[model samples]
Target: MSQETLSIAGFNVSPHHYIGGQRVASGELFDLHCPIDQSLLGRISEGTPAHVDAAILAAQAAYPAWSALTAAERKPYLDRFAAEIGKRADAFCQLESNDAGILLSRMKHGVIPRAMLNITWFAEHALSLQDRPLETEQATHIVRHDPAGVVVIITPWNSPLMLATWKLGPALAAGNTVIIKPPEWAPLTSSLLADCAHAAGLPAGVLNIVQGSGAGTGARLVSDPRLARISFTGSVPTAKWIAQAAGANLVPCSLELGGKSPFIVLEDADIDNAAATGALMYRNAGQVCLAGTRFLVHSDIRDHFVAAMRAYVEKLNIGDPRDIAVEIGPIIHPRQVERVKGFVERALADGAELLWGGKPHPFGAQYFEPTMLTNLRQDSEIVQNEVFGPVLTLQTFDSDAQAIAMANGTDYGLGGVCYGETAHATAIAEQVRTGFIWVNSFGIRDLAAPFGGIKRSGIGREGGDWSFEFFCDVKDVVLPKKPFRASFSHR
Candidate 1:
């Protein structure tokens, strides 16, 4: 998001399916639980297959006009939409905090601004994107970027507003109408986002959000044959299902599935600096896909690094997410808390050391402690899989090669971090299989740089022109410089 500190106020929430720029309520509904206190946030109308159909039709109807507009022509709508969201940044922050148990400060500082940034950035980038032209004696060939038809964006709950816009910005900038399916747990933001678009005077059916269970609503949306693109940020199984569904229609897809990314620390690394960065496993309560949950430290400094991490994590204020001063908050869901606890329990049974914080905090079952584990076997289930919590596992490596090997061993190759002298750390980072890495820092975002993953972590790159590339189709058009003779006569 944005690095600068900004003031937050408040915003309104809507309850309905945003179709054709109108609120359509449903008889059937689902419950939204607040993870901070395990309270029922509210009951949201469930989006059925019918709702999905309506949204798809709405998007299809809007597509002709939206896609007909040039990227430059489309920029005004994006700009106004961003302006609407910016005005409600404060209220958006509080609602997200209440809805998803994220620290309010984090939502303000690291997440909310991203919605505005994503839309504005992609709109500008689309304007800057140049078409490829090749000239020959006979003709000139140009590769033109055209909008894909209607798009379906399935966003994850961990960072709903930011992640949804991550795909939404490019999809809209490329002049495609979009339908978003927000995770049932944190569905409010998407509805509110839809309201923002409507308030910004966006045309009816240009941006739609359908909310409900993945099986009923999401399954129906992806299975539709009219989709031109499907961009998903979620689990592997769901992405696999999307791939299959899209496969049937020959529809293109981009999946940003979560990662079990690794963070490698060399013997020469700065202990305090490395520890502080590693402690960020607790950021966003460690629900982030790019979190470095696995720590591969040098054997000589493993103990010291773990000690420093424990000190850093312990100081974090863990409680109600609405509290501006709290550094850590609850896990997004109750089952996720139990799942995180289970991973640590299994590791403990397998002889892993519990360096610190293994169970639910005194706050309740919904809040997990900032957990740390060491003495883990590299082949163990906990070591090899994703915990998706405030859990950190420490594994010592005897050499840089071994650290890189251990880091690359996971099926995930999303984001990795290496810490040491610049050249040495960068040398090791060069061999790491992940799509992106930082030598001594963490979460330094560059929207112009390529971001995504290799292996099972994800399928494509995004940001800058890459986003335009995915959301737009390239068609070669050739024009003869002079009148052409008949081919048969030339033969």
Candidate 2:
């Protein structure tokens, strides 16, 4: 491969879809660009409805054999897939960094490694499945978990590979074949994932990749009656559309959507650590769905917390993502930059105080300064909506109840953080309406814990045994007693 081209598994794979264990070109193609420098990365095959149908057909064909394999039998293949991904860790990190504009160092140390761990974890989880017995006086009953065939996984661009693994890991572990529709902006890593699966000797059509826009490939996949389930991670609006389409076919769906999460700093909290953790609002250019963009502080320590947060945000290194030293990279694209900017401008118009940076970074066209806002109404758009940018809004509350109320006020209930005395924090964490809450921490995640949101954030969970249930259908079987005793009704 030349500097201008990207190849996967020794194949010059520009402008093609990985379907039925082969790379096939489409009649049309879409240009992929590196957001870091606005450079053309390459073209990817523009997936159409016909392409989606082909991928679905392939997955359906492969499902019976794949699902028939025992958990013990499937472990080695999944383990080998993890091993292949580990072998190409550096390549994956670089590709994802270039494609998504995330810091290469972050990808190497965080995202890519997590992707490998996610696959291995789910593979191990598969072995733990067992049938449950239901007690009965006159009959024997057993509940079995079975695979839901032909799962469609639609992943978002910000953390594509990691999020894909969140869905694919269990979907495959539960013995379902998958068709992955990666966001067009970040399709390379997923294609490479298919390559890894192929090299690991995964059966053909067991895993397929279709690359295109949501309006094209994603819509078709959700509408396909052959699909048993759909797992989607993206915006709330898109998840709604996916749910509607899946509903038409009565397909089971797990959606992990957007968030306007909250971070509360109480008077008794460790101000220094709280500020450091709260600064995660700027991580991934604040593209993370679990980001704590809303800050609720106790009025007693509000000034001190604001000062600490401002100092921390000012020190974030904004530069080329390829540079390992840089902390903040470019936004995903120019449109995202504008979208983030619009949020800030609207907040200002709504009388929110611009206490810190609020404009594009002076160094890059797609870079926005980590912004901080204060004195905003709780119902303001900036506080209520998902900014999905390097922006944070601050408000002070008089009491614990007030803080909890403010945190739960938004339509989103994805993630929340409570920082203070452990007991107090834990108490508040329980009251927050979000699906996941942290006490004194911000972004800590455990694979064993359920992860998803409530309200407008999303529907259904996606980790631990929750994922197992989501990808599997449960059936109850009852066996009659050998004596076949009949009950007599009283006159």
Candidate 3:
């Protein structure tokens, strides 16, 4: 491939499946295009069930040596890997921004740096894993943590590297050999990750990358009995299928699915701050799982909140992602743009008032304007479903109780935000059903805290000690109080 046709992080790129520390080619190929201009990015191998089997067999073969190493022995490799990523951070960010249609500014300043921090944080945290001892009068019990044999991590295209590292950092630190299946839409950076692993001197088969569509490669990997566990981040419908397949094999799986999270603005909230944070609905074109897509403002200040939010979104620059000044960029693909437009069109037909920017941008093929809608019914499809685009739905709540009820009404319980006075926000946050809540702010994440959701959003946590535990199994050893004596005379 020529540099103009297939370039990633300033390097001419050709995609291949990474297995047993070697880049392997397949008979079939799939083209990946840049969403910004629909330009040809590169071609990736279309992995088959046979490829999945090979990746699994490679991971299984590497498990013994990889797992036998103590955390102290493993930390150096992880540290080196983090350093390698740091060296190429700028290039990686640009590649990701172009490949995923995220703004270059956000990718360079926010996502890429955070991904590096994730690797470093988990590398050091691995050393803190210590056995626990429970002492009792009759017996003493000792608990040990052991790595699962082979783990499969499947990540979505929205935030491919960040989400993949969220699982990979801890999974590798816990000493499990892994197979990473990046979504077909954005798999470029993941291939770069495999390169970094090799440069860090990781053993063969310790980390593998398999590139293919979800239905073909994803299903095969999930159903494989050799897989010790699976960590997946994607749509709820796909998560359900993965859960069923993993369940049949009696393997544990961690799912981080979709969200239609609520952003509640109280009557006494600081209008400026609330509006600023609420504008996060347009961040990454609102494709984030934690994006607060539903707005439930107190009726007394609903008008003020709507006006402020509109002003904030109107000032946002929407154009080519490569432009550093652009705040909102293209959707991941043309199909996704159509899906977002469908949601807006249905809301208009259902009698919701469109405040601003509800149609496709005339400047680009895959661009949807930042959209705002008000007076939407609480049970309406647009209000209840995840648009996964730069779209926001506005509604009003009569009281604090009503706000809490509306916040917890959705099937999702991933993330939420409450804006008001400190004590008032705290009270409302306590009643919210989501796994994580932000008070007076949004998108502030601490790597040390556990992150996951209840209800249908997800099943298992994915940060701090929770991530370490997810890739490991616990074993208990009990000791008798005293030595036993021979009792042959009793017979």
Ranking by lDDT: 3, 2, 1
Structure candidate 1, residue pairs in collision: 9-90, 10-91, 11-91
Task: Assess every candidate by TM-score.
Answer: 0.95, 0.96, 0.96
C-alpha displacement of 156 in model 3, angstroms?
0.6
Which regions of candidate 2 deviate over 4 angstroms? 1-14, 134-140, 479-482, 486-491
- lDDT for model 1 comes to 0.86
> For candidate 3, lDDT tens digit of each residue in 8-98?
6576444888899988888888888999889887778878887888999999999999999998899899888888888777767777887
lDDT of 2 by residue, 369-415 (tens): 89899999999999999988899899999998899999999999999
Q: In model 2, where is the ten-residue run with the lowest total lDDT?
A: 1-10
What lDDT does candidate 2 reach at residue 126?
79
The clash count for each model shown is 3, 0, 0
Judge candidate 2 against the unseen true structure and give its global Cα lDDT, from 0 to 1: 0.87
- Where does the lowest 10-residue lDDT sum fall in candidate 1? 1-10
Better of 1 and 2 by TM-score: 2
Judging by lDDT, tell me the better candidate of 1 and 2: 2
What is the C-alpha lDDT profile of model 1 across 44-119, one tens digit per residue? 8888878888999999999999988888899999999999988888878887888888788888888878889999
